[model samples]
Target: MGRMYGWVAAGLLAGVAQPALAQEADAPSKDSGDIVVTARFRNENLQDVPIAVSVVNGDVAASRNLNTLQDLSTVIPTVDFRNGQSNKDRTVFIRGVGTITTSPGVESSVSTVIDGVVLVRPGQATLDLLDLDHLEVLRGPQGTLFGKNASAGVINLVTKAPSKVQTETLEAGYYEGGEGRIKASVSGPITSTIGYALSGLYASYKGNVFNAGTGHKVNGYDRWGLRGKIVARPNDDVTITFAGDYLYNRDNTPQGVYVSSSRIAYPTGVVTPNATLAGLLAQEGITPSANNKRVNTNFDSEVRDRNYGGSITLDWRLGGGYTLTSITAYREWKNHQTPDWDTRAILATGFPQGRDDGTVDFDQFSQEIRLASPQGGLVDYVVGAYLLAADTYERYQRSVTQLIGGAPVTNNGVANYGISAQNHALFGEANLHATDALTFIAGGRLIHDSLSYFHQRVSDTATGVSGIRPSFASSGKTDRVDYSARAGVQYKLASNANTYFTFSRGYKGPAYNVFFNMQAFDTQPLAPETSTSYEIGLKGSLFGGRVSGGIAAYVTNYDGYQANFADTYLGAIVTRLINAGKVQTKGIEADLNARPTDRLTLNFAVARTDARIKHFNCPAATTCTSIDNQPLPFAPDWKLSGGAAWKLPITDGLAIELQTDASYKSRTQYAITQTPDTIQPAYGIWNASIALIGDEHWELRALVKNILDQHYANTLAYGTTAGVVRYVPRDNDRYVGLNARIRY
Candidate 1:
């Protein structure tokens, strides 16, 4: 392992925020606009349930100017997400556990589902964020509901269902940050029992933000997306839906842009990369458009990207207080990109040759069928089946040039890697009411997984390395049988207070990366990583429901750790995977929502977690010792955030609203080996939005991220070429102006 995970006192401030203040039990809360989510896989009161859940509805997304899942974390506490190097690259860690890669061969620890269909690859899931009904974020373990691949939790995107009501919305926005975006959607009933919706998105950036002055070239970004959906209700007892989307963006983007931590304490170049670094210079010649680094520095790039996907669902009523539903979906996404990172790093220092034109293709299909009941009863049962298959291929060309007898000699290199995974499973959950205040949930799953890996690499006469055409073929098939049991005793201690204790178990399948990549080195197979947990919590609307909140504490143990890392010696890079020793994470979490008046609402969340190696005997097999005694990489022990939304009565049919969010994270090491290059320092950020929402159909919004004008990194990586590591900075300051529509 190259890094150690860290931990914190997770639930120290659990009772911080209050739930929504809209005081009604039968209808949805007005505090959270339309598009309420069924993220918990059940329809229940968001404030009443005991799960750790956060929701982002339609209006909230548009008003906040959130374009990708990475941007959503700014407003939602307990969520840490990012897309680095490539738009296809994304990592989402909830409760401090997740993977960092867009490579299909690597799977993310956290589970993601869209409209009940599992998203096999992160790249396919990175498609544009369009007209969605709502996004449900469930923190902690979701092993019971999500099955394999859900060691952490689940993030569900529930699209807007076909509605009988007709609606139309169009949006146009521009930013001082050299960015422009527009989106439009329309929906109406095709028949008494059928409905459909279609949408489009277009966004572009002029590539001028980095301010580096290099011909003002590599900083711009451009993209477009489309979405289509259909719903059919043949009878009162059955409903069906079909949907899909596509998005493409080109980026000649730059990365690794930094500034002086303190204007007076240091000079920019003294702390950041030198001018015309090899990595940056190489990017200039290829795709200099979507330079995220340039977007952060002098801001310039010439790059582009495209993403797309679709789905279909059928729900049927089977009478006898029972209902059955089936959801089938397919997704296809591809990206053609170019980068000059190495060139930028070696620009003037003689390492000068680096160029790569890369492309990735990802396609997936999934189907799930489940049944449940909405009636409150003493005993009930729910069962379902899920199947998923995905195929991904990535290919790239990189080259270096040199002076041969004063003439340039070019060397070209190519690498190809892919992953294909298919899963079939059946799961069941049975719930029993032991008492009026006690409900128990027990579930199990039987799954069969087929995992395959394909890899090949070639180096032309230019780069010095020969092509054995290193390639391996594996159709590894493994069957996984797992179960999750939850027993909870919810007791009414007081008139409005309910407290409960629960026990559960969950796991992430043993991925094939450990074997496939090892095959590249002609090695053997490693083991799988798994976890089990126990939790205790108390929740209920206190103070006559005026202030609602919950606090929970949990302990979890992890076994069979899998790690893939890189080692460089003599200027050459080597990569491998190893199954390490055991580790554990224990923590506490809490959140609150309070409304003091008709126009003011406040919310806050705080988490403290402790994640570390219980025993790591990697390089040495004899005696057991800790792996650097450092906290896990990317896992922060302390995180806290609060927000207040206030609506003012400015005039008739019009209201002025303001929202503010602030967050802080204690610093921690990003990788196993502790060096200046990979350690991430602690930092905080604030964002605010002011908007005018009107009656009938109009909205005007203005927002400023990094309200304090703080320069910081939301996501980062170290050691691009060994020893020389730098932090990648985001465009810390961005302000947007937006106009929107509605239909009554």
Candidate 2:
């Protein structure tokens, strides 16, 4: 850690010694004060929007090698991204609040919006981002405009639009550990009134974990995607745009490595070594330890996903300073996964060998229309109506091999389920300019949701084996009507500074635990989750527009927070989704960006989140332990991130740039049960890069991540066999890479 800090200090000193130089010809200056966002369904200066937002420009993302949400989380102190064994299990948290469940009926607390469309599922947004114009992370409840599933926050992604001028870009990168990526984009005008932009990407990475059973790396990914957009302007009053995208991904690395094995006698508070698991490990010639990167699974774990979407948008100037806009979209996503339940290849007389295979098919269609009065009016307003219809189908099978009555036996259980939903909403927001320095903002959304599900399960055995669930069939329907509202008062401190206080009400619709193990008790829909939030913030630009940032403090209380908890059923431990009684999250966040000179830029951000459960609604007939007042999973007390970049000109057409960044996270627990074994100690990672620029057409760069060779786990969980396991991220170790790009 000391060496890493020394390297950063040296780079800063070296940058200071060089004389001030002009900006790189090919790199456009991204002045923080000039950033514009659509936080309120209209273009507005970020400083005047009265919301806590973090913006990442496309150039900054490229310079920092950020291609996915997981990568972006390292730079934003208030955001955390967790990866599971498959896309369906991926989750994003904002301010220590998020939903983690595999049931299709449940909705995420954090919503992801791309362009003008909202993704129905979190997995749909896990793909690699492409050609982004900018990304805005709106902190706190955003249910007023983003609609349902935004009780916590919203991730809004805006892609580059069709450019009227002809342009082309190509980028290629290679990193240590057999990872490589290539991206290309082109934009030009096809006719006097028509313009188009197209982009494509291909990326691959070799597995980082070594699989002793197959003598090969186990966790790697291969993915490719294409995106295109067209804009047509037939008259001065109207414009139309068409956009489409497709993605294909294949990977075989979703399981975690073993950390330890132990057994605790129920109700006796006694600990003992897991002899059965130890014997299995010995038979497979495997050792268990923290940060272990080797595994000995007999079968390959694979996940294949395909996604495609298209949208059409129309904008018309309705005259008299009013604008009308409409967007229609359709999307489909399909995934297949195969996993080895036990991470060992051991043969025993009566022991169980378990395997599970599953597939998901999801489709959605949506439409939205809004009318906006032009800005500068005494009362500017926007009203919108939205409709969405979605369907999800899942097929899962669990197979086990065991010995019954001294004879070998094999049993299989299969489940098929489907969820259908429809949502209708009316939303509106208005800003009243009381005076030149004071404004009042109000927004509300009325939403109605109708959801239904059908599930069927069949087992080869009459009563099912150890790993197979019993035969069952069930169908249910639920309907919910909810509303979200927000009111705020903004006061202008100066021409470039403002302060605001806001009160908001957020809502998430009812959900049912519709999974392969659905039972009669799980058919009832969980109550809706709701939140009340109060926020105070200050935002502005200082030093004559050279610096820009914001600070915010907020407290939110939630009722009926849905979460997964462990329960005993049929003499086995099972995980189920239930509505936890109450939770409270309070935090303070601060961020700043400064361009002290034309050739230097600096940024820093910090957050302190205190998220905990206020009450635990223990289920009936279960011997549940009390976890009240415990910190929420993945909610670190403190988080910080900072970066510095400096450009020095060597000649009229050549320049060199130096950049460094680091992120720190305090200790955090990974389990809702608050087990001591699932705690992750504090850790920090540092990264640096150097680049050479030539005449505005081409450039080359070299970068290294995890300069200290930090060893840490992204997530930790209790294993199925009375042990603990952890998921190791790719950047868990030191790696060096090179990147090159060209533009015309």
What is the Å distance of residue 113 in model 1 from its true position? 1.0
Q: Which tens-of-lDDT digit does each residue in 326-381 have in candidate 2?
A: 99999999999898766667646545667889999999999999999988978999
**Highest-TM-score candidate:** 2
Q: Which stretches of candidate 2 lie over 4 Å from their true place?
A: 1-32, 263-272, 349-351, 405-407, 568-573
lDDT of every predicted structure (CA atoms): 0.60, 0.83
Candidate 1 C-alpha lDDT tens digits along 1-744: 111111111111212222231223224555432223465466666654556677766546665666667766655656676545566555777766666544455566678887787776665555457776677787766766674577677888766655557887778887766678888778889888778988888887665334344556444567787878888889988988887777777765454343211111011123443334435544543223212344222223234555666777777888877889888778777777665544243233333345556787778888888888755788777788888888888776666554446566666667677777777778776767777666666666666666666666566542252211233343444445555444555565665666766666656665655221224332233455666777778766655555677788888776765553444422333334445567677788887777777787777777888877666645322232245444665677887766667889788899987766666677755554333344456656566667788974777778776554444555444423322423343345544455555554
Scored by lDDT, model 1 comes in at 0.60
For each predicted model, how many residue pairs clash, with residues at least 3 apart or on different chains? Answer: 91, 0
TM-score of each: 0.84, 0.95
Which stretch of 10 consecutive residues in model 2 shows the poorest summed lDDT? Answer: 17-26
